[model samples]
Structures are given as C-alpha cells and as structure tokens.
Target: MAKRSIYARELVNLMAGHWVARAVYAAARLGVADLLEAGPQHVEVLAKKANAHEGALYRLLRALASVGVFTETEPNTFSMTPKAELLCSDHPNSLRPLVLLWNELEYSAWDDIVHSIKTGECAFEYRTGSPFFDVLEKDMESARIFREAMAGASRLIPLAISEVYDFSGCNTIVDVGGSHGNLVSTILSTHPDLKGVIFDLPNVVESVKNKMGDEASRCEFAGGDFFESVPGGGDLYILSRIIHDWDDEHSIKILKNCRNAMGSDGKLLLVEIIIDTNNESSFGNWLDLHMLVMQGGSERTEAEYRRLLDAAGFELTRIIPTGQWQNIIEAVPASI
Candidate 1:
C-alpha cells in the first residue's frame, strides 16, 4: 500500500509536470541567470534589477534553487548552477533563446491542445488565427528569437552529421530550408574542398548574407520556396528539419521538387527525429505531440519514412542516429 501510494504521488507529480517546466521558462524569461552571472546576489537586488516584486522573485528563486536550476548559497541570496549558466545568452551553448521562445509563444499554444486533439489541426493556428510561421514572420523580434533558438539548438547537429556522413565524396552540398546557413557553414568548415549553398526564402537568404564568416567565400545563398523548386548543381542535398513541418502530401511535394533538381547521382539527406515504434517513452515521442499540437506536422517512424521516400521516387538507404533524438536519413533517386 505504501509503494502504491508512492507511485500515486509520482503520477500526480508527472501530471503536474507543467508547473516545473513553466517555472524553468519563467526563470529564463526573467533573465535570472543573466543577472546572477557576476556572482551571488540577494533576491531583493535581483528583484530591483529585473523590475520584479521582491517577495515574488524571492519565492521563484527559492523554488528554482530546490530544483537544481539555481543555488541558494545563503538565505535569500541565489547563485547560478551549471544548469542555470546555460540560460545565459552569452554562453556558447546558451539555451536562453529556446527557453524564451518556448515560454513566450509556444507556451500559449499548449492551451489549445484540446482543440488540436478534437480537430487534428494546429492548436497554434486555432488559437491565434495565424500559422506559426506567419506569426513569426509578422513579429520581427519573435522571428529573431526563433532563429536564435534554432541556431543554438543546431550547434551540435552539424558536427554530429559531419562526423557521421562522409562529405568528402561530394563536391557541392545544398541545405534546403537552411536558415542563416549555420549547418552549411559547419559542413563547409570541416570540408575545405566542398562548396555549399544555403537555400531558403528570399528574406531569409538576404539576412544570412556574409553571416557564414570565413565560409562565406565557399558558401553561396539561394532564395526560393522548396514546395515549388529547389536549386540544383549539388551532389548532396540536405533537408534538415524541413520535411517534418509538413503533412505527407506537402512533404512529398517538397521531396519531388528536390528530386527534379537533384542529379542522377545526387543523394538526399533528411535530418529529423526517427521515432521508435516500441512505445518506450522518448523525447521524440513528446516532440511528435508538439508537432501535432503546434504545427499540424509529425515526427515519423522509420517505416513511415521509408514509405514517404518511396512515394517521392527515392529509396531509403540508411538511418544514422545522432545523440540528441535526431537521425540522418540518407536516400537516393530510385531509378539511379
């Protein structure tokens, strides 16, 4: 009975998990970690700096400290923990943008999860009367934050991909829907001989100009919609986190357009979370729900990927697992 009661308590905690997530989000939004970057400070000091109520700020920090996000070295004085450091915007691996992005915008979408479940539609769109991308486009600050969040999250993905995939054989690589050319720059950095292109919407390409630093000489930028057409002249075409934003029909449309542009020997690579079918709890499963609720997209299983590839006249050649719930799915033109 005691064990069962403990399990029941665990269930209740799990059910109320949003409280913890929101707390973390709140800390990130408040820039509490940023304020503590210099050293330990009293909650009153932090509250003044942040323009927040002292008592409420004190409670928030105390609660967060209990969760290992911050440390209360002395009464009412809080300092950053390693986890909290990651919330500092200047930190190399800072997740501040992601945290802020989620808390500020995506947080509200979760409120409409019930609507999504009922209609199999986008909760974000349902709530705001505009699609997620449209909203991001209209809000410059949000778009910048969203881009920073994506870039911060992608810091390791390019290295993981470069290590796993052999880009030496390919002379040119094109990243479809590659925002700001971060991934492309990473690849170009590793392979000196490989030239690359960052292809996306016109505005996105324009904003990313010369942002690739030293790799700018080797990397080019192209602007267009993937649904209509993609640039050619690359031996390897990479679609990282592009396909999953769409349904099967739209995904197929994009893939087919890529196929039209790809040469006979060119290979297509999709970077995504290849969901597990064993029903074991995983981050990908939760992310799949995020997709459903937020964008009307989905994270797919390997079998589903195979079908999608086959439908687009491509053959699924391999799946390379990257550590962070992502996989590099390699495909080739079926006829080739």
Candidate 2:
C-alpha cells in the first residue's frame, strides 16, 4: 500500500514540468531516441554510446520511465516506449524542436518570471538586453530552432484550421511570417487550386526556400519586414500566430498593411487563440503569460481583436471557433 507521505510527496513531484524538460533535453542532446530506433540496449551500453556516465544516465532514464517516456525491460536494460519515440528527430511529428526551444530560450526567460509578474514587462528583453526577434536574427542556431518550433506548431494548426475554415474561395493565399512554408504547404496540399506566397524576413526566406525545395517552386518567396510592408495582391491574407509577437501598436501596423494590400473583396484571417474575458480556464491564459515572460506581447480577447481590426480600417466580420484553442477571425476592409 502507498504511504500517506509518499502520496503527498508524489503530488508535489507531479507539478514540476522542469524534470520533463530536462529529460527531453537530455534525450535530444544525446540522440537517445535516435539510438533506440534500432531497438533497446543495456544501461552500460547506452550510456557509453551516448558518452554519458552510466549511473547518472540510469537515474535519468528511471525518472523518465516512471512517466512512460522509456520502458525498463529488466534491471539495467531500456527500450523505447511510444512516448519516447516522439522525441526522435526524424519522426514526422517530432517534439525535439519544441523541447529544445523551451529549454534554451524560454527556460532562460522564465528565470525572471517574478519580474514579469511584478512589472508586466518581458523577462526576455530584461535578460537578453534585446528584443526576441532581434536576438533571433543575430543568432543562427537559435533561429533554426525557432523556425523548427514554428513549423511544428504549423503542422498542428493546419489540421485544426482546415477542418473549420473553407479555403475553397481563396485563389491566392499569403502566409505572413510563415516559417518553412508548412502552413502554406498544408493549405496547398488540401486545396490544389490555391497558390501561395510566403512572406518573412530575408534570412528566414532563405532558410525556408532551402527547406521547401519543390514547394518553393510553386509558392513565391518575398523577403520584407512585416513592420514595413507586406507583399500585395493575395485575395486571402493569413496572419497565423503572428500578431501576438508584437505590442498593440505594432500589431495594428501589420493589420493595416494587410488592409492596404487587400482588395475590398479580400478576406483577412487572423489565426490565434482568442483570450476568454471571464478569466475562465484557457490555454491562451497560460500562453499569455509565456508571451509576457518571453516576448512582452499579450494574447487578446475577441473585443480586443475587434478594437485592433477597427483601428486598422478593417471590420471584424466573424469569429469561427476551431474547437481547438485557436479560432479563425475573419475581417474585411472597412469603407473609408
């Protein structure tokens, strides 16, 4: 039987997301999941292969095993569980990038969560002494991880958005700040008639083009800062999880740029989590905090979205809930 003290201690232990982060990071850094793809091995063998200390690596594996990340076949041998396989870098739905990004950039920023709570300022800027995007632009490795994380997110979002929104009417779709063209690829794959353009910074565009290959041939790549201008002439403009990266003033400028580029008949879709006003349970609430701690942007409620749209000379037409946390907010150019 479980002891009372054991129950209390386990409850406290369950709340530490850091353990999961560290374990995942270790698996990523050591390529443990990749090694296990060939199958399981003894702790001594695995540790030597990964260049880790046997006893310490065993302890880490034991901790992860309890959470079902890996399975202990016997006393000192281990095998990959289903959960562990997701960490494999070559897995189509791999979470390696997500784990790495959180551990590297997000984790460091979170060290100053107290400052963010107190001053409502981004801990990222406070810690790094530069804006998040500026730092990303300067650092190549971090930028690659960021792009991969964004692409992973895009894969999930495409499944959600395709189900709720009809892209049948769209001839040309522009994915603003689209990283690696994942969203556009998903869209084009589903709707063959649609053509696309990926708009992002020049460095990002270069990276995306290299990754996209054949898809790059079909979709145009335009390198320009969204703060300055966006490529014109797409009937449907999609800003997927883009606005939340900036303050209200900057977000409005991006929306206004889309407004100017869009024709009267064109549609503007902002794919994002609409924060609930009633302070209820929400994924966006947690994400809002992360944005604050990491980037200084806050998620917005539907009313806040409406206000931003109005300021940008667009009328909020409809809010289509995707059942998932994200919603498709459709807007149109307002009459001057």
Candidate 2 overall lDDT versus native: 0.87
Per-residue alpha-carbon lDDT of candidate 1 for residues 1-336, written as tens digits (9 for 90 to 100): 699999999999999888888889888888889999999999989999988999988888888888899999998999999999999989877899988887788888999899988888989889899988778767878877888888887788988998888876899999999985888898888889999989987767877885678999988899988888999898899999988888798899999998999888889999999888999989888888888877889999999999999999999999888776689999999974
Q: Which is the leading candidate under lDDT? A: 1
- Give all TM-scores, in the order shown: 0.96, 0.90
In model 2, pairs of residues that clash are none
Least accurate stretch of 10 residues (summed lDDT) in model 2?
A: 209-218
Give per-residue CA lDDT, model 2, range 1-336, as digits (tens): 569989888887867867776887887778888888898889999999999999999998998899898999999899999989988888887888888898877788998999989998899999989989888888989999998887765567877776678887789999999877888887777777889999998888988887774455569999999988989989999998988877788899999899878888899999999998889987799889888898898899999999999999999999998776788999989877
Distance from true location, Cα of 320 in model 2, Å? 2.9
Model 1's TM-score against the true structure: 0.96
In model 2, the runs with Cα more than 4 Å from the true position are 1-11, 277-282
